[model samples]
Target: MTCLICGTPYQSTPTWSKLFLNQLDSSTCTRCFEKFEVSESTIDFTDFLGTPYEGAVDSVFCLYTYNEPMKEFLHQYKFLQDVALAKVFAGNLQQAFQTREGIIVPIPMHPEKLELRTFAQVDELLNAAQVSYQQLLVKTKSETQGKKTKMERLETSNLFEAMSNIEATNYILFDDIYTTGATIHHAAKILKDAGAKRVDAITLIKG
Candidate 1:
């Protein structure tokens, strides 16, 4: 089989396949898995205006920017309901966090919206990443922020809550898009309030 992340050729055990089987419908070759590897240079978390996070203590990582292959990739995963793509996305993330240890939290979605989608896209991607993480945040049932302006998004849109004590000093926040800084800002805020030393936010795209 091939490595799904880096596209490196190698043999994979059935047990390993079973671990990530739920992430993908079919097993990925060792090479493809290796090629999709997530690295520090690959991780990007810049805002539209090219601004980084405030008091950024640690590095923020993102698999793909909102462009080209990344744009197409995310579009397929988000709108096309391409479940397999979720595995690749998650695998990339898993590789990114292999060395770092901490809680990996996905941006929460409203329960009503979650019901409509029938799944949390961020959660699915993180699951594919194959890293240990927790669903610590829950979106308060609030208005959708898509139609809102940047300030409005920052002002409204309930995105996160502390599910447990923030024991992990190194925390990473994951999301599909980095349109505005609002969503992640809220998540980081919640994590910090829970006693996390640092909160790093990442997104697939920055636009």
Candidate 2:
């Protein structure tokens, strides 16, 4: 098989998990996959501390740290519209979610941005991983959060509105990346306010 990220041909090795557990293997080869650094840094919630949104999110689980290879991967998959690249991290994402319990909810993109991007990048990740998820929130603000400063981002309000009545159940929010975490917090707050018992997040890259 050809490594999805580096385009180098490599062999896929079968293991106990693949043979018995039916675990899906990542599309990228071992060498290219190793370029994504595993993230161990804990996410801080001080930005929402002391606010109504304090404790909105229970915890955040990040798989990879932002790096050069991941940067290039995001550029090609998200901006260049390479939908197939979503499968690159399928094994990693699936394994992470298996140990967690919740109603998987993917963060929704703004309608305008989705139109421009031609796809919901976050949802595509879940689809590629074969993870079941619900669309529970709608992005309200149309402006991109990337251009905003940290304070400005935290100050941005009503970023998401609940799509339906949220049950008093645990929810796992999925996203493509976690930066200042404003986006994830906003979505979590809305769900919590709408009656979700607990909210946690899983992000592809910790930027």
- Reference-based lDDT, each prediction: 0.63, 0.90
lDDT tens digits, residue span 107-191, model 1: 8888887777777888887776666678888888567678888756655534666777777487888878765567777778777
lDDT of 1: 0.63
Clashing pairs in 2: none
Displacement of residue 73 (Cα, Å) in model 2 is 0.7
- Model 2 per-residue lDDT tens digits across residues 85-150: 999888879898999999999989889999999999999888988999988888888987878887
Pick by lDDT: which candidate is best?
Answer: 2
Model 1 C-alpha RMSD vs. true structure (Å) is: 6.2
Off by over 4 Å in 2: none
lDDT of 2: 0.90
Index of the highest-TM-score prediction: 2
What local lDDT score does residue 169 receive in model 1, on the 0 to 100 scale?
Answer: 84
